[model samples]
Target: MPEKYHISTTPVPPRLPRIGKYGIVDWREDCARCHNCVKKACVYDRHRQESAYLRTLKYSNFLFFECMGCFYCVQNCTKELLALTINSEYENLGNQYWTPEIIQTTWQQAETASVPVSGAGYRGKFAGRGFDAMWTDMSEIVRPTRDGIHGREYISTSVDIGRKPAHLEFKEGRIVSETPEILDIPIPLILDMNPPEFTLPRLEPFILEAVRMTDIIAIVDSTKWPECLNEKQRQRMDAYLPNIAFHLNSEAPEIPKDVLRKTRMVEIPDSDDALDRRAALREAVPGIVVSIRVPLNKRGVDRAVALVDQGADVIHGVADFNGNEINVKNPRFIKDMIREIHTRLINSGARDQVTLIAGGGIALPEHMAKALLCGADVVSSYLPFMIALECRLCSDCKPGLSCPAGLEAIGFDYGVGRMRNLIAAWYLQLIELMGAMGMREARRLRGDVGRAMFFEQMEEEIFGTLFGTRKQA
Candidate 1:
């Protein structure tokens, strides 16, 4: 047995005024002004914090909306002067995919580094799009000893990110076949570079810091090296080098041999000669894991299978930010793409040899586990870390635009702390989810659709013969 993987976290509060779901509306005009006010009896002490916040309020439109919606005050008020109201600003956060609720929940997790306990049960739809269309099996919750977060049992969330030989040969009672180097990370997550749509200057250092603290890998574009760092950070580059994986493209300048040798993994964009490039890279740096970044476009599914057939070590399939296929109408989701790729590889007897990394649209911790359940060895995150830095996903996120989050003005400690907290929250949540699913290992969770229920499969089983068949998006 090995030492359990743990992520130590401390509460890192938000700098900006929190955009919570519920707020208190006091109709002071009809107040009885009782000495024993209901506001005085808040178990969470939210009323006292709101009073302090109101005294130093800077933004007129931003009100203190930290009410927990316990409804104790609403029920106890004699004059019926108190009511719980929804915060308009909170409702307006993010688009349909990245809902306001998701953004607010991310904020809370980043701030507290704890699993969110919505006192009220889930009030959303029974079924929806994307990962929401599938639900994990939690029947094991009946057994308390299955809980891995506690000391009852140990659940392994670690995953390997390199190729494995399908079979081995022995000569003279010893293995004669060559052994491949395997890189194992405690978690099945890799922090990816933020999309060009919304980028903050001098933010890479904080991302690198979070990756280093978490002991995971971060995919960094090799073209922007040194330019993204300052004098002090550049001097301390060696310390950050081990946790970083350089991403190379056709247009990017050549990376030095020393940097590539220091890192455990490298990623290159998919091209006509992608396999040739992988072979060249492997020859240059022996035992280094090479990943091919494949965009989840029209040919993504076939392309992934083709790459595997050609002996690709790792294939990283990236969908759009919203998890849909790129440049296609009524696009298929990444979950479906992953299932297709996994099925293809398995049919070819190559699934265990090559690694699959899914990226884009992995916005939450559950999304991480869900992606694995859909057959990804690892999932990459780009937006969740940005959301940790108070990013509102506003229209003004581009360069030369006014960032509503003030991401440019934040210091390294504040930025890195929040990101680390978000990772910790996700780590704990993954463990709890795995425990509830009665899974003792992350690798076993891959393509374990038997432990998951898909709405499409259920609908088809119940109504498909009646309706002929429903079209897939």
Candidate 2:
């Protein structure tokens, strides 16, 4: 067996003070001077830490808003002076899709490189939209240390990319079939290029460094060639080639043979001649995996299945930045689209011959595992890395606009360290999730909907016949 995969992480503190969710309001004027102050009984000891933190505070507007909202002090306070307040800054973190809680959780994981733990149990809605409507089966969780994050058991998160032959013909002496080319990575993740909305800073070098540290692949635009690299990076460009897969659009210039030869994969836009393009690329660079970037719009499912039927190596079905289907009034979410495509491929008997890469709205670590369960061989991660650099998913992230996160001023070490930390945290979380699900291999998690339950499907089975059918709101 190969060595166990691990990601080394160091705590990368946030540059600015975090906008925590909950805070405490103390009405000291009405205090009865009780012997046992309610603040002293905080399970997390946040009140004492808040007092200590305020002593060295430079800004009066900055509040100690790290309350866990356990409600122990609120209920036990004799004077009824203590109240829990939600931070307004926290409420305004992201848009409707990228909720403030998601941003905050991403920040915590990136800073600490550890799983975000809430003292109170999950208080959010049971099910809502997209990935929220799907839940993995954790009925097999038996022990605390069995999660494999602490080395109790080995849970493999590795997956293979590229085309795979359905079966091999065996001769009397040895195998007589030809094996297709494939690229195996330690993790089933690919750092995708930033969407057009997040055009804040040029941190390509840092992203490439993070990819190198994690030993995963990153997709880069072919048009942004050497401009994305600095002089030092250009000198050692060969070292980063294997981790980089240039995305070739129609407008991209012709890539030199030398560059394509060094890289393991490349992605081209979905077009009428996409198969021809794949053939030409394979002929140019033998053993190179070519992924067709299919936009997950209304026609995405059929396009992806068609490509798979035509012997494409990989189909990268991408949605809008927020994971919604583009150019549709009632757009299906990424999860639904992925399920459709995966189901189609499975029915056509081409699922095993081609690899399906899903992208868009993979904001959380659980989304990675969930995407695999929905049938993606790998997932493309985009916004999380930007959020790791403290991006607020603001509308004004253009070149000249004022960035609330101050992304342009970030140093190389701080930027790269945070991204690396986020990746490590996600990796460990994936391991924990796999262990809880009683799964030992990430490859087995693909298309394994038996280990998951869909809200729509369950609603249909349980209540559809009784109440007619669920109507769209």
Candidate 3:
């Protein structure tokens, strides 16, 4: 067996003071100075840490709220002087979709590169919108030998990124068949380009460095090539070329033929003549994989089938930033769209011919696994990479306005380390999830509906007979 894949990580502290969920409110006027106070009994020693943090505080308006919310101090206080209060700043950290909890959890993973554990246990709803509406089966979790992260067994998370032949033909003990080139990435995740609002020229180097370290590919706009890279980076371009995928617009000038020849993969937007464009690029740059980016809207499923039938090496189904279908009031979620596309491809007998990569709402490690279960061969994300560097997602990034998170002034080492740590943490989680599900290969997990349950199906099966059809809100 090949050596196990492991991600080495070290602690990378956050740049700003943490906006923890709870804070301690002490009524000093009513406090009785006991010899042995409840403050000393804090298991986390939050009181002493708060005092130390306050003594050397740099920002005057920033409050200290690192309390663990154990409620031990509040419950055991003699004069009822201590109380736990929710921090308003924590509530305002992220918007509704990108919840504050998600941002904080991402920060913790990037800093520590460890699986997050909510000690208090899950307190949220059983089912909600998007990926939350699905659940994975953990029936095999009790098996001791299936633990992949602990080295008991090997679980492969590697995936290919090109066309795959359905079968082989041979005659006279010799095979004469053509096979397209394929690129194998260690993890089934890709680094996508950040949205226009979050784009930064200085950050590309760090992003490339992170991709190189993780042994994964990143999609970069081909127009920004050569010029955006430093002299040293330009010199080392060949070494990193395999880890980079270029994004080319159909109407834009073609990328230099030399660069395209050296690259392993290139992505083009889905257009009227997408198949023709793919054929042209294949003829121009042999051995280069071409992926068509299909918008995950009303026509996404049909488009994906058409591309696969027309010999596309890869079909990348993308949704809006929030994972919803664009310009549709009653839009289906990206997960549903991926499922529909996957099923259609299977029905059309083209499921094994090409790869399917899904993006645009994959915000967490679990979402990566869930996307594969919904039929994506691989998943891509960009927001978590920025969030690793403490981006608040203010949605106000523009000229003449100072970045609230100081992203522009971030150093290369810090940014790369944080992004690498986040990837390591996510990789560990993926292995752990695969082990628990009793699957040893990521390819086997693709479109394996038996290993997962959809909330809508369960709701309809159980309540439809009792209560008739569900009413629209």
The local distance difference test score of each candidate is 0.88, 0.89, 0.86
- Write the residue-wise lDDT of candidate 1 on 6-119 in tens digits: 888888888888888899998899888899999999998998999998898888867889998889999999999999999887878877888887888898898899998877
Candidate 3 per-residue lDDT over residues 1-473, each given as its tens digit: 89777777788998888878999999999778998899999988999999999999987777889898889999999899999999998888767778888899999999999999888788778999899999999788877637676886788999999988787777888766777789998899999877666554356788888888888989987777765455778888887787888889655677789878888999998998988988989999999999999988888878888888877869998888778886678988889989998998899888987899999889999999999999999998999988898877776666567876788888778888999999999998888888888888999889998999999889999999999878755
Kindly list the per-residue Cα lDDT of model 2 for residues 1-473, writing each as its tens digit. 56788889899998877789999999899999999998898988999999888988866767888897888999999989999999998898888889998999999999999999965477889998989999999887885535465776678889999878888899998888978779998889999998988887887888998998999999999888977776888999899999999998679788898989999999999999989988999999999999999999889888888888778869999999888997888999998889899999989888887889999999999999999999999999889998998888887779988887788899888988999999999998898888888888999999999989999999999999898778875
Best by TM-score: 3
* Model 1 misplaced stretches (Cα beyond 4 Å): 144-147, 465-473
Q: What TM-score would you give candidate 1 relative to the actual structure?
A: 0.96
TM-scores, in order shown? Answer: 0.96, 0.94, 0.96
Global CA lDDT of candidate 3, please?
0.86
Candidate 3: where are CA atoms >4 Å away? 200-202, 250-253
Error of model 1, residue 260, in angstroms:
0.8
What lDDT score is found at residue 266 in candidate 1? 93
